[model samples]
Target: MRNPSLYLLPALIALGANVAVISECQAGGGGELTAAVRHEAELNQISMLEAESLLGQPNVHFFDVNTLEIWAEGYLPGAVFFNVRDWQKLLPAKKDATLVFYCANRLCTASVLAAREVMKLGYTDVRQMPDGVYGWRISGRPVEKP
Candidate 1:
């Protein structure tokens, strides 16, 4: 009989290669949220430039998922404070409205979680700014102070 371990070697090698690819992608500054979040959230990821372009567009709404204290420090101009605990009441009545969610930075997953939550709540148009407000501020974009 052929050696069973011989067949296992190829599977292990493939798994290792996949892991390496995933690590490389994450290290490439593709935003901190993992593949699991992307898969589970099933929401669109927008770059800082794309988010900036959406600014001031009618029907486009931005939501800050950071804490009230953090939000008070600064936020994307025209963004609404998204209280995760009270999101049901704060969400727009139009489920199909274009909603963009963001948090502190790429490392913060709050926006991802919030986006996923709203998606589950039957919102048809949901997007996440993976780079978040930090990326916006560092990019010299305008931010509104409370």
Candidate 2:
């Protein structure tokens, strides 16, 4: 399924605002993904082990950016379903908390889109777990769906 945010990103990017491109495109987008990966790594990324440890904690927030159908299958406990609505509501309140963004796998750009958006919001402790749900499952961690 195609996320509607993907189509809007390029137009937003053309408006000359770096953040506007991803601000509402946290669901996913396609572009210079290499740059996204590099930047996410430079900004700060989390390992599966670290992310697992933070699950269910109040100070550490998780955002899952995978497709709704995919996410319906399973996701890390306590992870908020990231779309335009939740981001607008929850992110503003917990901007200072440690935020972890993730999608299906390292190749998936959804997480990167989310991380970039959060960073643009001036979040200091943002991190992307590129390995995503795949890594979490392979690591033998449990998954849940709400």
Candidate 3:
């Protein structure tokens, strides 16, 4: 008779491999955000009140990373629409410039992704308004429509 343990070995190996893949993805090898990435993003997040205070500041710039259709509906006052295809050219030349990125709402990850891309490009003052434009609107903040 064949050993029962031998038959289970292949299943265990497959499980191990699956676990490894999940670990790699959570480590930023894939599209998912790793713990480190999320922590770093949290560190750079700004409260709606804080963002409001920064408005009109010379060095502060807001970027709306929502789709063009969503952006056209409304956006934070003075916010520039961030085109993912042409992001590199759209950013401020100064790496230290205060950059605030936002999307539709807390559930939206577009702003986080955009902020990460900017951070990778060596921008030091990257900030994310995770509450996004939805929060801004709910808070009775001004929104401009093009």
Candidate 4:
């Protein structure tokens, strides 16, 4: 015996349309945010390991651009914590330094934004550690907490 639903190709198409519409309504906002993030990453922003490798060299300073609460939790050793929200007040003091900014993780924009601010402050050498503190910790790199 033939299944009637299998023969109803038009009915299947209609059901698929409804499913797509429902899913789109549910997922649109998240999808747009994810696309924006991916686009930003594709902009070839600096990354954590790059910052780490560069740290082994002279003149590079690692700056944790996360909030104090996040910084106090833990961070890559030797990193100086600076609040991104208050960079204008803090970054000026270190404007001449070679700065690499990092935040919560790779998905975060805080570091990138901080790097831009550093650049604006006349820091010739500035980069965003895109993979951030999470990558540093997960890679078995040295870290410290207080």
Candidate 5:
């Protein structure tokens, strides 16, 4: 049998070099709390420009779920690397803060998993950054890196 977690993640919807704002949602047994997440994304997905505008919002948090290699390449200025292995230990102390998650790009699902993880951790304000760093760069935004 296939690993069930993979099914709960969202799939990328690429249109040529662009990512569709909305993508289909997949999940375990087909409809879990994550299903609500997918639906909310349909209505509230954040754009690179919109996210840029909210950069200074004190209540917002950004989570970077991109692979270590991708992160090493660079990432959003305030992004947090709650990677699969060490996330539990680094869980944000604030459970009610607004959270945004992104992966390699619009097509990547790692962010979706991260979003779900936060929800399980009791975070009520979560938004999936459908377009990850690739979108940021394409939109002319610079990232912070070592």
Candidate 6:
């Protein structure tokens, strides 16, 4: 039989590349123009993998800017539910908090809108995770439900 582990490296690389491309495409026209579009927080725009790494660090907070039902169905591990409508109240007043936002998937606008809202609130370090929930699920990352 063929060695199963031999296929793992290529498969993982392909998956990672695909995820990155998907995220880039989802970022509005896919370039500096898209990046120029403010998404609430001015935090460094990064891919899902980078977001995951940031999440692993202490005091980094993940905010779900989707509806209650969607948040209840699934969300990134340790993500805190915050409705986009009530974002002002839910988000911290501090400008230095390491806050990240995400939505249903790569195609969802929830995360973008949430980021913009955060920026409006004067939070200096905010970013929207590119792939959102779908990316998280596809990457075999942990998610939690209400």
What is the TM-score of each predicted model, taking all chains together? 0.70, 0.67, 0.71, 0.59, 0.66, 0.64
RMSD of 3: 8.6
Each prediction's RMSD over C-alphas, in Å, is 12.2, 16.6, 8.6, 7.6, 16.2, 14.4
Q: Distance from true position, residue 3, model 2, in Å? A: 60
**How close to the true structure is residue 41 of candidate 4, measured as C-alpha lDDT?**
25
Ranking by lDDT: 3, 1, 2, 6, 5, 4
Candidate 2 per-residue lDDT, tens place, 70-126, comes to: 788889988888965657576747668899999999889989888887888878889
Could you tell me the TM-score of candidate 1?
A: 0.70
lDDT of each: 0.89, 0.82, 0.89, 0.72, 0.76, 0.78
Q: Give the per-residue lDDT of model 4 (tens digit) for 30-70.
A: 54535334322222357656666776566667788887888
lDDT by residue (tens digit), candidate 1, 49-144: 889899999888999999988898899999999975667787889999899999999899999988998899899999999988888889898999
lDDT of 4: 0.72
Cα deviation at 113, candidate 4, in Å, is: 1.1
Q: Candidate 4: where are CA atoms >4 Å away?
A: 1-44, 84-89, 92-96
Q: In TM-score terms, which candidate is top?
A: 3
Question: Which window of 10 residues has the lowest lDDT sum in candidate 1?
Answer: 32-41
lDDT by residue (tens digit), candidate 6, 48-144: 8888788767657889877788888789888888775555777665678889998877788877877876777677778888787877888888889
Candidate number that wins on TM-score, 4 or 5: 5
How many angstroms is residue 2 displaced in model 3 relative to the true structure, after the best TM-score fit?
A: 38
| TM-score: model 5 vs. ground truth | 0.66
Residue range with the least summed lDDT across 10 consecutive positions in model 5: 12-21
